[model samples]
Target: MSEIPGLRSAAGEQQGRQIPPASLARLTIYLRALNSLLAEGIERVSSDELAEAAGVNSPMLRKDLSYLGSYGTRGVGYDVQYLNSQISTALGLSQDWRVAIVGAGNLGRALAGYSGFQSRGFEVVALFDADQLIVGTEVGWLRVSPVQDLATVLGRTRANMAVLAVPAGVAQSLCDELVDAGITSILSFAPVVLQIPDHVQLRKVDMATELQILAYHAQRAQDPDLESGPRARAAQ
Candidate 1:
């Protein structure tokens, strides 16, 4: 069987510096594109072709890749497998990162059941909630544990990252708890902002806010009478 593609942990240091988030995102996109090419039996690809696959222009792709010190051969193009591995290394996908979800409500349950996280080297080892009734219940082959067991579960599982899916009221306190438990990375789904230690890294997913932004763009498209419309320009 072919070897499974692994990723380097983003928690790693490169040149004693942290990799930028934008670079990390693009690296993942590039990795996916390269993997597709490899699966197609394509060994080499020009920057232009690869960029198109990654949904970016050639120059932009080259600039992004330059951050990793990757330069393709002058005329032969880049080796697909080599570039993919390099990007995986830069994004820290080569190592598995155990994840713990702190909420067992709807969103938490959905996240726990998602298979993509595990496929990408993130294993959801611990699932937690505050309700006594919810605790000890199974959610996708794993039993939901009480939030009170967080510290022990974190230590026993050595979980370095966590997901905060609890209510907005409880998010911050639980976030603090996660930081205290030695979890350095977190993905927060709460509608409100969470305060954590300066050393902790956080990413928030606000579906409502995102949908509002999308709605604005969609409204503008439907009504060219907005600022972007020629009619609006004449009125101004």
Candidate 2:
């Protein structure tokens, strides 16, 4: 790992800063870009270069990184390894996250087999399904367990995080079960609104909604009148 210069003292100031949602999202992108830079054996990165790597404007990247305290020098830019560590700590990536995937369908199996999750500190410890035939099957290194044993498997694996790749119809019930079984953080790929306890953090990824948004953007790009509209510019 490369060393970061001059900003070690500012590390303490990053705590308790309330980064806006938009900035929080961008920080993840910056982290990915920084990781790529590190893999290339690059040690230092200028704000402009880093921003371009992250696919964001320099000013926006700077603004996003402000929540974590400035670590870049006037001419030398940021230290890649140090910045990566700082971002990782900020995002709780330093801690071990055991993830259990509910519904060992195609999506669940794919997510379980993803190499990126393990590289980023998320371990897929368990996989569950309602089908008896699928339950005993192996997905990656993990054997799919029966959904009836959800709580039991979670306890055995000491899982703290969960992913719901189940259908929308059964998503809510499974989510409730996960919360009841002591899981606190959940990422749901199911396209439905779930009622979770306030203490449980839930994040929903609706692929259909994302596709619809993409369709809207495509339509706007093809239409001369829509292309010049204020709404289209705002969307961009």
Candidate 3:
């Protein structure tokens, strides 16, 4: 594993600086692209190629990578193995981060069954839901448990993060309960913004918002005004 400098925790009254969320997210996409390249036995890649594969602009990709210091060559591009190692270290993928999933609905079940979580640093250690009937049911290798067992499961498994896939109506209360149980890091799939303490880290994934964005772009694609700019005459 490569050494990730400045990623260590800080002492009292001194909160450590974190990588920007956008950069962190791009790092994940870069990691995935790098992994694919490695699997294909490709040892070198350019920023333009990587950006295309990762669905990002070349300049933005280069800028995001610059946050971790300059690892790419001026003209040649980046070394695949070295870049992968740097990103892995920076994202804490070199260490194991146990995760617990709250809510055992379709989305939750899908998440539990997904293998990507384990491939990265995240490990799904527990599956939790409030419904009594759903509890004790096996979803893949994990057996569902009641939400009340959150604290116990967290301590027993030493999970530092949680994912909330509950309905929008109950998501906030569930998030509060998770925070109270000492789970600091959260990934919420709910649409509503959750209220958590400063110490807690919350990342929201709003499906509705994403769908709305997609719809906006779809609508724009059908607009004659938007399309006219491509072949329009310029004013002299």
Top model number, TM-score: 2
Lowest summed-lDDT stretch of 10 residues in model 2? 226-235
Best-to-worst lDDT order: 2, 3, 1
Q: Which scores higher on TM-score, 1 or 2?
A: 2
lDDT of 2 by residue, 21-94 (tens): 88888888888898899899999898999988988888988877778887777767888888888888887788
Predicted candidate 1 versus true structure: per-residue lDDT over 1-236, tens digit per residue: 23322335432324345557676777788887887888899988999999889887889788787777544676667878777767776677788899999999999999999987876678999999999999999999789988999999899988888999988998999999999889999999999988877899999999999889778767876885636434432110
User: What's model 2's lDDT at 223?
Assistant: 78
Q: Backbone clashes per model, in order?
A: 7, 0, 0
Model 3: per-residue Cα lDDT over 37-148, one tens digit each = 9999888899999999998889989988877767777778888987897778777677889889999999999999898887766889999989999999999989998988
| Candidate 3 or 2, higher lDDT | 2
CA displacement after TM-score superposition, residue 67 of candidate 2 (Å): 0.5
Inter-residue clash pairs, candidate 2: none
Q: Find the number of clashing residue pairs for candidate 1.
A: 7
Q: RMSDs, each prediction?
A: 5.6, 2.2, 5.8
Worst 10 residues of 3 by lDDT: 7-16
